[model samples]
Target: MSAFTMAASAVGVKVTTTAKRASAKRATAKASSSAFSARKASLNGVSLAAFAAPSVAASKSSQIRALRSAVFAAAKADRSKADDPDAGKGQRVMIIGGDGYCGWATALHLSNRGYEVCIVDNLCRRGMDDSLGFNSLTPIRGIHERVRKWKEVSGKDIELFIGDVCDYEFLSATFKKFEPTAAVHFGEQRSAPYSMMDRTKAVFTQTNNVMGNINLMYAIKEFAPDCHLIKLGTMGEYGTPNIDIEEGYLTVEHNGRTDTLPYPKQGNSFYHLSKCHDSTNMIFCTKAWQMRTTDLNQGVVYGVATEETMMDPALINRLDYDAVFGTALNRFCIQAAVGHPMTVYGKGGQTRGFLDIRDTVRCIQIACDNPADKGEMRIYNQFTEQFSVNELAALITEAGKKIGLDPQVINVPNPRTEMEEHYYNAKNSKLQDLGLEPHLMSDALMDSLLKIIIEYKDRVDKSLILPGVNWTESASVGQQLEKAEKVKA
Candidate 1:
């Protein structure tokens, strides 16, 4: 007799060898009633009823415990499949700000990887461009056209939902209909310069970012509580500090005590401040409601080409170089292409973390593949390299020189009040351990980016590059608006 049979015999239970083995099989098959029925129907050509009858003398509690063990074994099998690439073959993913820069790229990346992707966007980014009197230097295709092009290129259909995340009704309805397994949230005002442009923008940023996140959390809680949330946080949430910045926490030793807390945030702009607020609410959600979230505190993403975007011209991602939405390195690439000077602000010693756009999508994929546990909030500082403003300008200038553009580098007065030079170091080993091979900034990469910019240089509106949005309190808002109007005209 096996150990199981011996144990049952020792329990003062009348058990034959056949019945003992059948009881074990029944317990393992309890995950499904049909499986249990099939296993219990026979045992070594004998009916299970022979042993399961009340006269068999097995306790009801023992039978119950055996069934519980089967259920747990089945659950463990299901969880083991979560890490497989084929596991997400039929799972749905919803991209909240799918029409914008990061969202569009991520949508394509996920879609190509065999996920059912649905994109929800209000197109507020484009609307903001209209209000600010500038546009992406490269003409971005309309949503319909972009989606159509993607389908043509890859034969993968991506569903589009035109709506605002702030509208709770719309979000709830979306959550009900799609029932996504994962959500990538990029649906908020993202530009610091735009948020600080005026009081109205500042308020709008807070309302839109904070409320949208809240509604999303509630929608998930009510409709798809098990869905993993991959929120796009910003590195700007933690401003330059004297000490090395950890992923999302700092361990401090005080008088006879030690505590680990969320790293202190000192966002210089209202947009980043809104992100800080979002972080707090997410932490609360995980603690209070057992929600799962992975907040990617990403750095300034540069470069425009991705594996999908480079496949076809129509699928090109948005490339912005204006004062409001553009990053420093992207703006530098466009300036070099258009024969404009690489505008370095102040002493140009301001340093920031950056990653190529390709890595951005890859990082999101890694996040989805490795989900956070329920009641856990995982944070990853998403960047590969760091460079100062002057260093980036020099790199762009040199790349331009090699291509015969010979780009001019000029020092411009800093428009925003920020640290021109600061001590900065941040740890980012978490994502690296999860299999993210970063695409570093290289001359060949710059050469490829410049080539694309040169193709669109003819569409460059030099005047629109510098909108007169002053950050200093002493600067007259009226004068700034008037100057912007003149430039627009």
Candidate 2:
């Protein structure tokens, strides 16, 4: 009989198996019925980023195919403690959008912890955001330049790829070439306002986000079936829910029949709707193909930099404060830089889960090491705290005033479509159980981000702060406001 059957027959005793095939790790939950919680007290940190992912310079496309195949075959074999990311030996990791904000930081953070990392992107943001005449407030260097800087600082080379995930051939080729043991995907169009601005933006979101993700799954199965995939999904995918968010799944009783299913996603805008579509597609693939995947329904992430990027100004990734891609905290901090009042949309009572970039790295690392079983899919709500937009704006105003910026708070006519105020509560316990001690969005972290903006205040383009992306509700109002936001290219 299988070990699973043995555990089932043990009667009131749970048998857990690890890569080591050691004793089960469990604790009886506080439930009256069949409830069990599993915990791993210690997981070795992945120690591969600097030397692992970028094993060697890419040879010409015509060569090194055999070497790449060997590496991939090794990755697909049943894993052991030696390959565990948590073992302080870090996995060979690939971050699809490693040049983007969260992706860059995550790549570096894991590298510092000893994981080998490779970044893949088509620089699509440059294409999309440039057309809108907005630039990420801080200048972003190309991937080659970034790899050079990383090597100079940490004596490591983060493999770089100028490939598009939307292209199945490129994606499949990269997976075969790198043979990464794990991948963290954060490449997606992520702007609610922009997606609602026009049909083109909406179509772009749907086409690019879904296709890119689907391609990744296909490539993983074809090239490296054992690699763990930790994909970044937005909390906005859940929209403004009335109940506490469960960790990726929920149980409901319908007609006295109870079943657990993926939580209902209530997306508000086109961008968010695409993320919801992504989760649905990922779930279908994971269950059908027995692929290992972790969907992190993360909330809006704040804070300026992580432990990795602060190493040097040259190492910093894109920091967008304009309306197009700017998140709330980033935008508010930028407004303070230009002496502009914090822009409050509508009544500004919409609440969202928020996380610091530092904790974001921790969360990602934890998920990578402790993957779901082959036939089991797990989801985690990735957020630490919740705050309304108004509350956050007030905090920025207060923080800016202390720095002598005297930043004001202005109630702007919300150009795009969304609920101004809504309920949002999500559960994020599974990650904690996996040993994630979260880093809260402390005011100190806020100040750190603000001070970075302070140093770069001269580079602040106040005009880009609001691109006036409008929705059906206020399309005409947005036309007039759009003229006010573009200062220059």
Best by lDDT: 1
TM-score of every prediction relative to native: 0.80, 0.79
- Lowest summed lDDT across 10 adjacent residues in model 1 is found at 6-15
Tens-place lDDT per residue, model 2, 294-330, is: 8998888876577558777788867888877888778
Every model's Cα RMSD, please? Answer: 16.3, 15.8
Off by more than 4 A, model 1: 1-87, 474-489
Give every collision pair in model 1: none
lDDT of 1 at 298: 98
The lDDT of each candidate is 0.80, 0.72
Which consecutive 10 residues in model 2 have the weakest lDDT in total? 23-32
Q: Model 1, range 108-131, lDDT digits (tens) per residue?
A: 877776666899999989898887
lDDT of 2 at 221: 79
The C-alpha stretches of model 2 lying farther than 4 A from their native spots are 1-90, 473-489
